[model samples]
Each structure stands twice: as structure tokens, then as C-alpha cells.
Target: MSPSSRTPSGATEASDTPSEADETPALATIGEFGLIERVTRDRVQPPATLLGPGDDAAVVAQPDGRAVACVDVLVEGVHFRLDWSAPEDVGRKAVAANLADVAAMGAVPTGLLVGLAAPRDTPVETLEGLATGMWTEAEVVGVGLVGGDVASSPTLVVSVTALGSLEGRAPVTRDGARPGDVVAVCGRIGWAAAGLAVLTRGFRAPGVLVDAHRVPTPPYAAGPAAAHAGATAMIDVSDGLLADLGHVAADSGVRIELRRDAFAVPDRLAEVAPALGVDPIDWMLTGGEDHALAATFPAGTTLPAGFVEVGAVVEGEGVVVDGEPYAGAPGWEHFT
Candidate 1:
């Protein structure tokens, strides 16, 4: 199930105790701390991090008194592939996806906790590349990889827990949208889906669409901006626009009507669609992973910078494009 298709639930946590072993031939020779030391080198610390790496646990400053947190897991061959993405790209993309969730809540990201489980034979250099990728993306927004853990497993799995502060603003969840609200979006969409399609087909053309698949650039600032502008509800376009918007509609109990004329397919996507034999607009509506922010504002309210109005919230449920229900493949689903 996708995050958008789930109901609220809670669970208890079990304490984790590390297993001890002697004389292991795996992990490319150096011990766990050695690997940690290698990756932790030269990493910049975020302002929100009170106590960074090497502590028993990290202490982050949440000035708002409320912390907005979300965790994401990326498994090799499931969420990412070594053949498809460079090690660094994988790390950067992992952080970007989770960071988008923070932004979706209309909060400013503060710190990140990365957890990596890889095959025992994994190279430390490969892991360092991944760390470099993580720090590169985190530094882009003036944050750091404050804390994380490295473990041995049969496959590579990257998990990230992002922390953000709302700065006293109310969180804009999918449930807050209401009738007569204006729908808007900030940042690029469909580029990642189009890029992935091109890559899967073995097209090596260098373009913005292609790069997007490797490293998604989420509109990090738009989250806080929307909150300051009084956005009613918001979500990140990790899944397709329609699918994510469906969450807002279902939760808010309002219909969202999207205007086709309000948006246009990017030239880069249109340029690649012919060779791939698929409509670029399909990617726009259904393709996700661009990490763009989708929000609903009250009618006649001035929108935040970078947000463009795309639709309106109405009395009903579900989403529509061009005055009718969208009959396309919904969005990214975890299981078939």
C-alpha cells in the first residue's frame, strides 16, 4: 500500500540489541565503526543539530516544540537498483524523497537519521559514496547527516528518518482541504517518471528529464512558504498527482477538479515521449517521484511564491482533470 492509501494505526516498538560475532570475513575488512568513521568524514552539520554524530543519540533543536517526522525505506531492486543509479545518486535520492515528506507537512527540515543495511561483502568505499551523496543533498538545504547506523544484511536497504520544525504553524495534512479551496503545485512534475522510462528503455540522452530520475530536486522552501501563505492542506507528489490528490480529496471529503489548461507538459518530456511511444501528459498526471508539493489554498488568497494554481476543491470526493474523472493508472503502488 502507498502512504496515501492507508488509515491511521499505531504500534509498539521493541528494543534492538546488536548481535556480537568474532572474526568475520565480511564488510571489506574494517569494523563497523571504521565504516562509520569513513562516511562521517567532512560531513557538514545542520544548525538544528545540537549534538551530531558519535553521540549515543542525536539531540535536535525543535524550536517550535513540535517535531514533524517521517521515515522512508528504499530497498535494492525494490525502491532502487545498483545498475540503475550510482551509489551517490541513490543516497541523495533517498534523502530527497524523505525530505519531501517533511516539506509536505509545511515544515522546515532540520536533521536526518540514515540507516543502512547492506550485504556483508559490501565495499566501504561504495558506502562512502552513498554518504557523500547523502551529505550533498542535505547540505543543499543547510542540514547534515546527524546520526545513523550501519548493519550487515543480505541486501542493501537505505532508510531515512527526517525531522522538521513547523515554527508554530499548523501542519497542513491531506485532511484539511475543504470545498472552494484552490489547488496549487510547486516544482517540476513528471520528469522523474519520464526519466525512468527513458532509462528503462536504454536511452542515454542527457537532459533534465534523465537527470531527474537520478537526483530529484524537491522544492524544499515551498513548504514553509505555503504555511506562511495559509495553505489549507498539502502533500508531496511522490506518487502521481492524481493519486496524491486523491488522498486529499478522500481525507478532506471534497472533490478536486483540475484544469488541464492550467499546466503544460515540459519540453524535455515532450521531446522524449515520441521515441518511448507514450504520452508525456500521462507521465505528468500519473508519473510521480518528482517530490513536488501540492497544496490547496482558499479561493482568492494570494499563493506563495513558486506555487501555481491548478485546480479547485469542490463539494464531493475524488479528483478530476478537465471536468471529468481521471481514468488513468492511479499512481505508484508498492505491491501489484
Candidate 2:
């Protein structure tokens, strides 16, 4: 930063931006422009993204006439760890979390913009790996990287902004569920949490659980599919399912009652949970970061594939399991 931009107390004197003194230093090795070039290099822009990187700003066509935009940020040590999560996993997880929001809105994620803030010491190859991961994951969902910013920070901070189109469908929000709506979930829950538990305990768990913690595969098509199937409300389970569902209940002024027996715990978790001496139900109900989709469809509506009934919207408030209050905290918190 310029001297004028520095704080009066000299607190900002330790700049995270690379210094010119070391020509071979971290980011200075590639420089800002070079880093941008490396990340955007070989990226194929989709038709919706009329213009991509290498411009003042990207221009994405909103064919549906309304753009669905959402952003999420992951902080190193807080959201992820370089020691445990590879650079690629960090990039992919960031993309998945943001895209899940677009899906939650009942929209098709047409493109993504990644805003990365990292310490200058961060290796250039690491950032490139991150870029490659972003592109790979975006391609999985048929979108491309549009544009974003790279900046300096004390630690790695990944921020992804996903742009989507609703195709004339109404944006699904938390407040639309009615008393009789059937609650269904697509994707999964608890795996990430279980993976986290394993990580925290420093014990080896199943590879799938470890992978779940590293990179979540949100059901990208489920959001639009549910919307097309006439879902009344929807949300992405970045937080725990119970926590996120509580938002739906509060917004819709209806109680969401989940039947524990109905939750489809992934088969792998059966043995894994037993070994860990932890109830899989705990993770199923309160595990966050899975990026699953929980939605409410009209009662008796033929549920689409991948969506399994978990509960119902009833006349009341908050969320409950088997008609009783859940004893644990509902979900994850940001900036707590």
C-alpha cells in the first residue's frame, strides 16, 4: 500500500504485499499479472460468460434476465488448513460452497468468480494448483471462471462469487414452506463433520470421509430440479441440516420436524461411527459444510431422484427431531 494509505499507528506497516527488495520472493517471483495469467490460462469461457478474464471486468449474459449471485469466503486455519487440505482441495471446496448457494436459489450456476487473498509468501505453483482445481470443478457443473481479484493478506482467504440463472423460475428462499410441505434432502450431511472429527483426533478414518472433508460434491442439479418439481422452499446445507432447517422454519413460520429414522446415513458412516464411538445421528443432524440441499415440496408431490424425504413442515417454529427439540446447536457460525 502507498504511504498515505497506511494507518497512523504504524499497525499496517507490515505489508503482506510482496516487496521489490527480493526479486525471487514468493508472489514477486510470478508477479500479480503473471499470477492472473497463470490462473486464467487455458480456461474456456462458456457461452453465458460473454467475457472472461483479461479485461477490466467480466461480462456474463443473463439470458434469464435475472442473475442469481452469492458469495462465500474461507479463511485459512478457520475454514481449512494447508497442512491438511491441499491447495487444490481448498480451491475446489471454495467453488463447491459458492455453487451450492446458486443451486439453493433454484438456479443454474452459469459462471464463477474467485477472489483470492493470500500472503505474499504463498507459492506460485500452489496458486496455479488452486486455479486448476477451480476450473476442473467448474467444468463438472458446466460453468467457467468469469473473473475475480487477487490480493494480499496475512493468511489464505478464498472468496468465491457464483453467478447463476433461474430460467424464469422463482428464486427459492427459506420462507416459502407451508405447514404441509414435505421436507426432502439431496446430497448428504455429517461426512464432513465426521471427517473433521477424525482430523481433530489425529486418527486415520475412511478415505471417503477424509475426502468429504477436503472436497464436497454438492448436488448441483438438485436445486433446479426441485424448483422445477415445484419446491416451496430450499436452502444449501453449508451449516448443519438442523441449523439450516431452523432458518426455513423461522422464515416460513412453520416447524420442521425430522424423523431420525428417516435420515439416510451414508453406509460408510455405519462402521466409521461405531469405531469412533460417536452416534452418526449427531453428524447427520448437526454436521456442517456438506453443501447439501434441503427443500420443501408440496405434500404428496412425487419427489425427484436423489431427494429423500426427511421430515415435514408443520404449524410451529424452529426445528425438531421426532417432534422433540434437538439438544445440540443447530449449525456453524461465521465470524464467531
Candidate 3:
């Protein structure tokens, strides 16, 4: 469910530990170090890792002599709800978001660091599940969880920092777009937003939609591919298509004009939107968390595989859809 639709429970910390008969143990019983051991024990680290968890800090190698880093924070009730999402799902979402940031820079992820805060009474299983999810996603890019911190808090909080290597390639930035560049996007859009809408409305029969809200499949390889194919600028669609493109526009001092016909509403979203009395196109336009990569390439440049042309960079400012400013909200904002 969306953060706006729910409230935090403000639960009290648990004091008493469960007996041996209990199948699930509370964090209070395991203690901080024990919980860490449970999550990190026997896990394999990739070759990029110089050292794994157990030290005060981790050591990772960047062959290009430059390291790319980004951090993301997800808090209970604000970013996710346990009732609506499993701990594994939450874990994967947290890691995926940060990894996508690294990917957007045309870097290959090297390692991940996590910081977790939860009530003493929280179930150890929950944290373990989260760790599993994080590891699974990290494995997709052949990276590992090198180190992290855990603490006690009244509310649950997860913070992840992902590090990457550019591998001797020029890192693509949002400020490089120019007039006459073509805009393209790779990977899915609107599915997570549609999923959030479904969950917020209190119906969860469609597993695909709800599952999408729980996890995002980012085009990690596409970032590097776009860079190698002479992409001029790029950004991940964490907030929304128009909202994120606005950043590229502001930074590059150019206008982005998108064609509505360029986007085809996924049949799944098309079928679900009418039942919910909403437009599928709206979700594609403004929904966040899809983690799709949007980029600009010079005109006449051959686009990378999986990238579909959707717009063009022009001599102007801001973004326009079908030659007009979008009437709906451009994207997500934390405070407003």
C-alpha cells in the first residue's frame, strides 16, 4: 500500500524472549551481533570484494580507480508496510532502488552496505528474510553484501548504500543532453504504480500487479550498453518518467518533447485500469518505482537493444507531452 493510505503502528518493544518451543525468535533474544552472524554467515562474496562482513568496514576494489556510490533510505509506513509486503520483498526493493542508481551512472555494482533499525521485539525471521532478498538481488549483478550495521529503534528503518565501478568507460550523467538528441527508455514502466493503486484500493487478487509493487526489475546492463552506444545523457525513472526527465532538462538546459503514441499501455494495465476507473496512460506517465532507464542519444545514432525511442531533445526548457505541458503531477516529491 502507498504511504499516504496507511499509518505507523508505533508498536512497543518486546522485552521477553521466546522459549525454546517457539519457531520464530525475536531480535531481543538473538542480540545485535547474533543477528548479524545469522545474516552474514556462510554467504559467498564475489571477486570484487576484498573483504566481507566481520570487519569494522569493508574493502572493495575499483579497477578504474574511481568508485561510484549512492544511498537510499526506506522507513516503515513511509516507504512500505509489512502487512502489505513481505520482509523479503521489502529487502529486495531497498537494494534494487540503490542498485538502479548505480546502474543509471553506467557503472557495474561492486558491493552493497546496509544499515537496519528495528524494535527489539521485531521477529528475527523478518530481518533474515530481508537479508535473503537483498542477497538474491545482489547476486543478479554478481555482487555481495560486504558490511552493515544494526540497531534498536521504535520504528523499522532500512538504509542501503551501493558501490559500483565504471570499468574504464565514461560515466553518463543527466547534464549531457543537447538539442536534436533522441530520448529512449528501456525496461518496464507503470506496473509498480498500478500495483500500488490496486493495493491501496483493498483488492489483491491480481498477483502480478501486487508483486510488482513489492519488487522492481531494473535494466542494469542497459545503462552500460547505452553508454557504450554513445548515449549523451541518462537517468533512472525512480520518481516517474516526466519527473525524472525534468531533471535531465534542467541540468542539460534543453526541452524534452515526448510523443504519446510512443507509449503502448501494457495489456495487463489496460485491462485493470478500466475496472479501477483510471487511465492506464496516467500510470505510465507519472508512476514511480519502476526503475526504468531513460536516456538521450544523438540523432542518427543506433539505439541499444531493448531501448525504444519515446521523445526528442529540443532547444527549449522543461518537458512537453504531445506539444503541451502535462496537466497532471509530473512525479513524486517527499515533502510536498
Candidate 4:
């Protein structure tokens, strides 16, 4: 007969208030459809998004009648850890990786589609945080999360598909680099590796490096700008500069020789690397996930904004540092 247990009609009612321990319900509590409703609600779509979530599929406009697309997948233990990063950070990193790929192709991003797999016991708030982070990164390039799907699984997995427009330009692919082309890069290179080293060593005092590992700040606009400026070949440094440049070399049948002194160690990396007993140059050479753009231009071609000369394409094969193979591991590779 207590008022707390009574409805407006004054009839007896079950308690609607949840205990403090159960305040945030698990995914099972809301069910799949409910979770979708929570994440998709109130989301704004860009003009390119013809139809967003709630439908069987999404329709995005391709202004130039050609679309560029790429996908990246992140698994819980392999790609990230909840204890090491917030859910939002993981979300941003996932979307950023795919978006970087679209940009590397010399296109402007239009929309994103995500696929999520997480345990049923996961908290609903975590998923919402993920969605929020995805939207945040998408808006950086003025795009939207057009569609996605969710499923039950033992481990959390995020797969993002980024679609883009070529805008009447041919894609700057890996095979376009020619001998005598100058090589250049357009963003931070070794910061993420330094951050990962710090995180692995049980310290986070230098937060800048740690944050880079969580959310990559790619130079999105530089992609199309490089294309307009007549870049020959381009690739995002997701798997270290040397390894990714090797892809361009092999595809174009040329050798990339880099000047060792071209990469002056940043002051922050120089200060922190000694404490971790690692060389900053190794990070610059082998670090992955920075998502910086590396491209080749004809000799004497004025480099685009934010780009600096680092090397040159030559009449040979594979990537070399100072005319020799790099001593450290090239980059990240699965199933070695």
C-alpha cells in the first residue's frame, strides 16, 4: 500500500526503480531492436545520405557517378582493450581507419556503415558511447553513419565501411609511382608507436602519445588536394611507412630510397624514447596506425600543403632506407 508501489490509478504496481547495482542494464535487457532505437535516434544525416537507418539499407548520393569504398575491422583483444581505452576511443579509431583508406584513394568521404558484434552481457551505455564516437569522427569530414548492424558474440568486433566520391578524378593508386618521382609524407608518423610503447610500459604521463594511439587524426583533406596537385602514387601509413611504401614500390616496380636525415626525431619522441629504451627513428620507420598519407610526385612538382619531401623513387625494387634495407621490423602483419 506504499505510494512508491502504487500506480496513478492507486492500484498496486511493481517497483519501476532499479537497484543501484542494476542501474545500467545489460544488452539483453533492451534487446536488439531497442538498442538500435537508442543509438539511431536523433542522428542527423548529411545531404548525401538519401535514406539512413531504420530501413533495410541506406542510399547515399554519388555526385560524380563513381563511388570509392573501403572497410576495416577491429577485434577486442587484437585491436584494442577496454581497460586501456574508453569505448568512445575504440569507436573513433575504427571509423578513422576506414575513412583514412577512402581518403588515401584521393576521394572525399560521403558516408559510413558499421557492423558491431558484442556479448549479450555488455552494457547498453557502452554501445551508445561507441555510436557517439563514430558520429563524432564522421562529422569531421561532414559525413554520416548511414547504416549498420549489430549481433551477439563472445567478443566485441567493429567493422566499418567508408564510402566516398571521386569527384571526376582518377584514384591515386599504388601502381602509379615511377622512377625519378619524389616521395613525401603529409602527417604525424611515429607518435602512435611512441604512445603504444608508453602504454605497454605501464605509464601514461605523456598523454599526447597515448591519445594518438586511441584516435588517429588523419589529414583527410590532403588526399584530394594531392590528387589535384598531380600525385602519382599514395598510401596511408597504417602499417608503418617502410612497409606501406614497399607496397607502392612493388606495385609500381620501383625502389624507394629514403634519406635517413630527412626524419628529424620530434622533441617529444626524443625525450620519451630513451626512457623506454627504444629508438624514435624505429618508431618513425615501423610504427603503424598513424594513418599519415605518403605519396610520390614528379621531381620538381610543387608538393601539396602539409607535405614534406622524404625520399625518391628509383629504378629498382622494394623499399630501402639510405639505400639499404631497414634493420627493424617493417610493419604490422597478421599470421606471419
- lDDT, candidate 2, 185-303, per-residue tens: 99979999999888888966688898999999999999999999999999999888888888888889899999999986779887788878888989988898999999999999999
Q: Which stretches of candidate 4 lie over 4 Å from their true place?
A: 1-21, 330-336
Ranked candidates (lDDT, high to low): 3, 4, 2, 1
Residue-wise C-alpha lDDT for candidate 1, range 175-211, written one tens digit per residue = 9998989999999988999998988888756467778
Please report how far candidate 3 places residue 193 from its true position, in Å: 0.4
The candidate that achieves the highest lDDT relative to the unseen native structure: 3
Off by over 4 Å in 3: 1-23, 329-336
Q: Rank the candidates by TM-score, best first.
A: 3, 4, 2, 1
lDDT of 3 by residue, 1-336 (tens): 001112225643232343343567878777677788899888999999998888778899999999999999999999999999999999999999999999899899999999888888788999999999999999989999998877668889999999999999989999999999999999888999999999999989478988988999999999999999999999999888888998999899999999999998889999899998888888887889989999999999999999999999999898888999888754454201
lDDT of 4 by residue, 1-336 (tens): 001212426321122322234677766667566777888789888999998887778899999998999999999999998888898999999999988898899999999998887776788899898888999999999999988877666788999999999899999999999999999999989999999899998997599999999889999999999999999999999989988998899889899999989997889899999998888999998898999999999999999999989999999898888988877754544202
**Could you tell me how far off, in angstroms, the CA of residue 128 lies in candidate 2 after the best superposition?**
1.0
Q: Global lDDT of each model?
A: 0.83, 0.84, 0.88, 0.86
In model 2, the Cα lDDT at residue 290 comes to 92
Candidate 1 worst ten-residue window by lDDT: 1-10
Each candidate structure's TM-score, on Cα atoms with residue i matched to residue i, is 0.90, 0.91, 0.92, 0.92
Residue 213's C-alpha lDDT in candidate 3? 88
Candidate 4's TM-score: 0.92
Model 1, residue 198: distance off in Å is: 0.2
Task: Tell me the deviation in Å of residue 55 in model 3.
Answer: 0.7
Candidate 2 — which pairs collide? none
Looking at candidate 2, the ten consecutive residues that score lowest on lDDT are 1-10
